[model samples]
Target chain A: MEMLMNPSQMTKKYFTPGVMLVSLIALNGLIFLALRLIFGVGAITNLDNQHPWGIWIGIDVAAGVALAAGGFTTAALGHIMHREEYEVVIRPALLTALLGYTFVALSVAIDLGRWYSIWHPLIFWNGNSVLFEVGICVMIYVSVLYIEFLPIVTKKFIGNVRFKGMLAKLNSPVDKLLRMLDRGLDKTMFIFIIAGVVLSCLHQSSLGTLMVIAGPKMHPLWQTPILPLLFLISAICVGFPMVIMESLIASRSFKLKPEMHVLSKLGSYIGPMLGIYLAFKVIDILIREAFVYLMVLSTESVMFSIEIIFGIILPMRLFFSKVVRESPLGIFIASMLVILGVVLNRLNNFIVAYNPPYATTSYFPSIGEISVTLGFVCIEVLMYRLIVKYFPIISIPEKAGVFKTKYSIQGSK
Target chain B: MATQGRRDFLKSLSAIGISTIGVAGITPSITKASPENILSKDRMGVLVDTTVCIGCRKCEWACKNAHDMPSGSIDDYENESVFDNKRRPDYSALTVVNKYQNDKTGSPINVKVQCMHCDQPACVSACIVGAFSKKENGSVVWDESKCIGCRYCMVACPFQIPSFDYHKALEPEIRKCDFCFDRTAEGKLPACIEICPVEAITYGRREDLVQVAQEKIKNYPERYNNHILGETEVGGTSWMYMAGVDFKNLDFPTLGDKSAPGVSESIQHGIFSYFVPPVALYALLGGVMWISKNRDKKEEN
Candidate 1:
């Protein structure tokens, strides 16, 4: 597979854009450093005591993690369901997941009041905090992801017979041990899969639970005990659509074959999840008797309606249509809308709808905050590109061995 | 060989089943016991008689002075020109007195806003790093050292009382009224209670505070509203309020008896109490794996 993708051709297509993206990322980082050194968070962020979290927590961390749920969801569908068709899309989903989690971690670091004490969670265990659960789960999951990607790393680096022989001798026992480990991982992968699903459920809901505790401070439109359920379902709803969007974008950007069948099948899962989410959302408002507030058509209500229509209803309609689902551009646009809806939902919950009676201040993200966030995203994409370029993430066909045999004979001649 | 495989499968199945049942049984009891045993005792609290308060910012000023917080100008409080506007507790100001204009009565009612010091405070429950805790004497105290500065407490607080010093580079503690826990511990009233020229703030045991609030309501029927604001709101707040007007006029959140902390904690503990769901999921996966493995074996043959 590596030999087939002529290096010169790959470089000509990818090198310039990759360099430009990296330069933009560096420029963002430089601006962030200036903000950190001179102005402090007060100068650069819209955060106040009343709105301590703002976009960093809402959009970057919470919504970002929810979008990244594609990784586990796709992995589970592919491996657990034995859908070999999904195998082609799994690595890209994993890459997105890795980058999304990385961005979340970065957002957390930026949002912390005492940024230096970030390692306190690992050092001291706070058993009661929902945040403690989030921290531990995210940290462990990040490590688990890297381990999951280790096969790609190893396949990229070790090549020569002498080196391979040395590694083989050293790793033969370890390879057997790893294969045994892989068997154990395969057998118990369901536990981790279920745990990941459950943990994501807990934390995503806890994100809403975090605001539910705000009680009256949280806008009535966003507050409910059922918030956790809404968040969990919404995260799952956004997850597959994000996978579709990411796959389409990455494939086009990398000039790789599009996995349309897998994405279309994923759309089937997404369509129903969005329906269930909207039903619960409407039912929740009705139960809370908050529909009266929507009738007034306030700025908040209009925003809420826009979020629902564009985010859920529009994309959902597109997903159900077979013609649209088959189109790469249509799926990409729907995926973007789903992401937009998730982002807006989180923003409304965390910032827009939080009504601290005494403090009526509205927040807008500072340029520095935006820069840091964008820098993290750029770094994430760069790492994904590098990994995919070097590693055999996309599995080659068994028949490719025949091509390799023929190519070797031609090279000798 | 078939019998042996069946026996092994059954043994695996039973192991999974028994462990799941055991986990399900143990989880609820564990969750119930943990929070119950950790319940704070001798919680110190305040009883505020809104009938007595003159909308004076003395308590607000005294709180800042006692805590060594940055002082807002005295004119900021006294000038009626600025007083009509509602004030919120912020990083600098741990307490605020706001006027609630009642349309029915055609009178302006004053309510001093501060931490409710809920018996089961959501801020305490929400703090995964244990930055916030209910003191035995009833104040919801914050430890800056334990704080990861996540400000989940700010988001968790029902009263919107907890304020984060987001501007500070280091040691940004959540600023809120502690019911003058440090002063109260030394056998003195909180600074707010001490300096209230109108004697609006009363500090005592939570039980006594509720009793005082109820007595005031009972004794002065015309002077006070029928309800004590915190007696049952959010599972009984430590701070009770006796207001001249309805509490809702003052923007007090209409809360139910169940504490927010209890609701979230119950769900957290309920879903994650034991390894039941994971084990069950694993068994289901294992069963699928087994069938697939056998099918592959047959295909090879």
Candidate 2:
């Protein structure tokens, strides 16, 4: 038996024009964020009584959560399925989910009118509220994501702990702490992995349930009792594709060979997963008699069509082809479609479907709102780049023994 | 007096005993906030007679005064020019009277708009932090300290009554008609009901108010629409309306008889019901993981 692969930090130039551009966008967002904090949500948002949520909830929290399903999906595949081939991609996926959820939480805090009172949901119980369920689940899941990510921290710094001057005295203690923590986590990691998958399922579905209470305020097309089911299925469908998309991008960005073998295999799984999602969607439409809505060609109908046709169906069809699954560009485009489709679905659910009675004007996100969302995204990219460059997230064959001691290193796969 | 006092004390003791038993009986719904037996029979409500309203907007003035939002003199509300555009309750005003044309007579109909204060308030059921509560007196009052200002209440509300103070970056409250809970608690009418010049708004026990609304419509079929706006809308609101025109013409949403939170709460309970589904899911995943890992190991061996 031989070690198939190992995870190692990428050695690359830390800064580039692209990084600078992302930092600028993040800074632009920070400016608006300061204005939002100093002035109010009203100052930078188009949200009013009729539209209490806008792009922040749609794109940042809901879409962000759905896209981050990669973490749990990859973890389940690698560790639970014992598919060692997927082990190389797991750390990157884990890092992405960790940062993805962190931003979801950060955006939620920013979007709250009383951001300071964000901790209120912890102590005050509201069992009837879907939002309450969502809040609690997301909070716990975020913590779980961090715990799932703790191994990376320990792996990166265990034997490598170093410091300057008088602080060097703390190095041995820190190293001892890391080693103990790593050992404890190694035994307990399975529990967190299972918990992570379960938590993701709970909150991803609960996000759709958040809008079910809106009742008649939501357009009939998107409003259904099976909303939570749809959300969960869609989240699951998007998981592997997100992994494929990110892995390809990371490979390209880091100038390393894409692990097409594992990804192509993952790609093969996407077709059937997507088919399940599309079947549920079509069955839902048929059961609800929602196809009549398609005939009208309104914005809702059009958006729904785009979501199904381009987002789910087309990508799904593309994935079935052995060529598409095997090609980098084809899989990337297919993955991008699924990602965009999920984003559109969330936006439609949160924004487009809502139609408050007596709304004098329809709501749109202000420039400030758009800027802030873009800023958070840029910051996320910058953080991801910084993390992989410095930490053992991307897989390489050298330095395998730093974390896992039993790699034998005898033969090749 | 001593003997009478003794009898009174026993009555009080029995009352406490009965209430505790009742509370124990319905504790689950209370904790879950569907509150089956908790809506008091004597819960106060308002019956708004839109046909009788003159659009004087005096109630609006009184509401602002009572809420201690900024206010103008009573004379300022008399301007008919404001009715050219429709109005809704916003941060500046807790209630507003909007005028609509009567198709039958071509005369203007004045409709007073505010919180319906439903028997089962969507706001109370939707608040992420349990900030909003449906009081025994039928007012859906929110505690400021508990509110994280998530604004899900605005989305949940059937009438879209909740408004926010978006201008204030700090402590932006979800402002709406509180049914004048403070005033009603002091054995006084809601400020708007008290100041309604035409007596268009009548405040009484919800049970009595429904009866009165029914009688009014029955006696003057020509004057009122056959339907009572809030009697069955979103599971009966504390503030019901008897409009001459269909409520839809007055910008009232046509909602079903089911409480707004019914489907949502059912789903929430289904998913988290005593944590059965989640536990089962965990066990199922654990099983799959075990089988898969064992299969992999057996293959290698």
Candidate 3:
């Protein structure tokens, strides 16, 4: 990145071959989604009475919420903790969170048998339910993300409003609304930032509480009373790595120089964060004497082993090393590993550990299920790319010919 | 409600639509339709004596017929071929009878499977919309109007009894033996209990049923297992069993005495206890942000 910088929308071509491929995958997924909506969830997915929640819940909703922790984590460091060096990553993180939650909401609606009644939770809330907690928090946090992203929208169109013919007269009022929104948000942004972090903590842990009710239905290895605490810690640990992973991927995709200084500084905290989570996880297993279950070589044990070895310990060791933290590629790999670890942990918890009695066959996501999940991911990437092309989300490129942030001139950190 | 015709279904739908809009006045903490699940000493229960059952499967036919479900004929139930493979209570059949080959007698020990109607039902605690309610009669009933069909109830049931209608594109139901809430409300015995030819199923007040079960076990020591299934399983269920052999061998999911939703709900209540934790965290974060900004401003000056 250039020594002097400000966030500017990219001028590069948007429709590359990679994006075209992604669109094709998105199209495939939408086709299956149509089938699901018309013919019911059973028609498109392998979900049965034996296993009600497939990878759509496991990957799209649970893992989606975990991976999108970047928004709040970065917000805490940059705004709450007043770490100005991390400010550049905040906009992009907020966008990722906004878009990530939209996918989660879409997945939940798709996963539910009655998509029309999805809004029922808002009025028909059951405080006793862990899922109710997850649903309400995710709903509010998505709105918070949208509110958090409003500044970028306002910034882009504040004075740049241009429309043809009669619509041109309304552009000034629209710009006035944006300016008013921008000013109001500036005063109230702190509340949303704090609320975002608090909401994240509540729902992230409540997600783990979701399976605690399953109790004996889940395997002994994953079933613990401290499941919520473990979930909270892992979510906190995964937050920075997710931000680093997203930042690196966005930079590489846009053909811009990565922000090594900020990312490496972010990378330095990963070791200790992951170390704390690992310690708690180990202590939980010891307290429960769950190692006995692991002694037997089963799908549950192997998946647990892979999640710990490849996800936590390996990345922790890497992040602890100076060589890995300083290089863009090395930090990127370590962050990706951590991200994958959290994703795998969520899948293992939701899919593998949930063992209902009288199940003659185990659950495996069908091709259509996989296609829809993959399609959601593809669409997310396409949105991220398009948003960065127009919005001032990525502030890493050289500031030579790019437009200046005029309204935020005096507000610069 | 499960087998209601199109007109009845539409009427129910309209009722639900109005109630949903009516919910606007009600606080989310206490929805209007959310029943107060008060336990009673006189709550009804059933005790199955497996040793007495002849495996006639008349109970299965009666259950479906009472629920307005299609069962070809009472003759079809006596085919005796369903015992070839173990079955669960699914959408089509709300109750099923399974025969376990027992060496104690030449005849197989037949066990009936359906919702336990737990004293502390996990489905009641886990339903996202509070759709399930445990009545004073000990029947755990679900409202079709309220259920979103997320199947979280199916996941939470320790006995794995609640089954969903996956095939229906619209208004799919979570089917389970509702302990014959309708029949019991009319002061009539459950259809299965009424139809039992051999008096295999004994229905009465739950406490009376427990005493009856204990008397049966004590009177014929060799004919029954000392333990009564569901007597203490998951904090006790409305339906219980007395078998000659161990229940684990009878294909019942072995469960502890603790309720299924106990840990999860405690954790939930602990975290949100008067919302103090979230509020304090908010204040703490605001304080840190204020101090950090002030320190930066001082340094700039």
Candidate 4:
């Protein structure tokens, strides 16, 4: 395995003929976004007064934010927990989070009717509103994430190029700016890291608070006084799994051996975190007596059962097994299930469980809505590929044996 | 005595530290008083006597006309075919009248359906941008300029009264019964109150209306149901209803006396009370950072 110091040294192929499908999906999404802007939300969406928010809030913003939990969780484990062994996966996770949040902000703009008034939350403070908290935290957190990523940018750009023409005169100043930024970040990076984690916690839980205000509108199965706690816990549980899944998938895509040793240990943390989440969930149900509704075999009941059993409990059990953790495929499948569980939980809270009594019919996302969501996802993937190809986001090994399954098994144990 | 004094001093220190943390947590919530807009005692309201409504649909005609919406000829609103389906107040129609049979008398009980304009309105509390407000005149009004059209108000309203102009391409407003804020401001009754041929609706101070409703129910126990529709449900709406038939049969939701925003507001404010929980969380995180840094030094050595 070979490691390239600069992104320019990596392959710069734009198309492989196989990526046409992705490109086409992204194009369709871009067209629908244009339609939404020109004709208004009514022209392109199946959204009515009853269903004010659709897949844009549920899938694109809510689930997208939860999926990005890998960044903060891995940062805590590696930097805060001083787990040097987990450092291999932290940069990729951080990059994923930065891109993830950028798209969430973009998705919120698309979802708003008056997209231009997106900055209202910043200036006109509604401190009582959970959404106000979410908006402010996200705005600040995005800035913090970029600031955290600056050292990487400076490291890549400094001393690499001496520009010519008009650029030649500015080259020394640019180099000086990078050096200053790099130096400043080295001393103060921990403060931003701490702030990032704090901000993430505030917003992730506040997302649940948004749903909590729906109160009677949300079905009892999903609605609870501790909804904010549930949301925060589920996000924390999924964070490590997300990091593991991304690392494994990236290794496979880049034709490098998978980081099974670090990932399996990461998998071990999921079981305990998942245990804490499940305990709260069961207690919440019992305390509320919502278990009665779960017995009716209705859509909410069935969907809730699938979310808990297949997405959570099944994967949690898988993570506990030593053999499952040791095997690359086993850990991947387990992490995927946890990710699916968190995604399902967010979607269910935002859409399925929200039933307006006066609504003439149930809401289903229009093709345009689905396309826009898919387009954002495609953008995340393409951006990740582009950044990883160009930057030193993914750490590489000096020898071939480091990523072997047997090597991982022996090392992790 | 020396040992006892030392123990007492240490106990006092622990108690002081713990109390300081507790004070820090609660001060934020206390200083920033809960944003509960108090409804005025003398606010105006309407008393809707369903037993006397007569199913005329004249209020519907008057409402549309007064709001500058298309009424399509006042005579057209009297068509009986509209009664075949129960209709809600929409963008074009600010109010509607539905007919249901009084179970005991086998007579038609006419019910007027529109925004209740609750004293503690859920829409006002749920709106993120403070677009909805319960006015001094007991009108729950929406400010179009402030509304980002998130439509959270629609979801929050227990009555589901707020309707969006979904068909409009640009500058669509959330259409609802404004309780005739414009007319009432000019010392005129709401269009529905003025247009009722039977004089079934009584418009007055909310406190006076409650007394009037109570006296009527007490006087004609056989003619009216034992309960008032909006008197207590969802923290008492301005529009009170007295009907021969049970409100549930007349399509009124069976909501408790609790205000719609009460439960959600309590839980949200409770968790975030004082901002102490978040501060404690950051402290714990800082502890982790310190521990990890120490661990790193040990490993390096």
iRMS per model, in Å, is 7.4, 14.9, 12.3, 9.6
Residue pairs of candidate 4 with colliding backbone atoms:
A7-A390
Clashes of each: 5, 0, 0, 1
Tens-digit lDDT track of model 2 for A86-179: 6777878888899999999999999999999999988888888889888888998889888877877886787898999999999999999998
Candidate 3 clashing pairs?
none
What TM-score against the true fold does each predicted structure earn?
Answer: 0.84, 0.93, 0.93, 0.90
| Model 1 TM | 0.84
Query: Which pairs clash in model 1?
Result: A129-B128, B42-B137, B43-B137, B43-B138, B44-B137
Model 1: lDDT of residue A257: 67
lDDT of each: 0.71, 0.84, 0.84, 0.79
lDDT of 4 by residue, A23-98 (tens): 7888899999999888888788999867878989998889988999988888787666756577677778899999
lDDT tens digits, residue span B124-220, model 4:
7677666777787889898877777667777678887888876564667788999999999999989999989898999999899889999999999
In the predicted model 2, the residue pairs found to clash are none
Model 3 per-residue lDDT tens digits across residues A1-413: 22334677877899989889999999999999888888888898888878989999999999999988888888888778877677777778888889999999999988888878899888777878899889999999999888888787877788988888989998889889989887767655666777788999999999999998888989988899998888888888888888888888878787888888888999898899999999988998998899898899999999999999999999999999999999988998999899999999999899999998988888999998999999999999999989888887788655574432211211322
Candidate 3 vs candidate 4: the DockQ winner is 3
True contacts kept of 4: 0.34
Provide the TM-score of the second chain in candidate 1.
Answer: 0.83
Candidate scoring better on TM-score of 1 and 4: 4
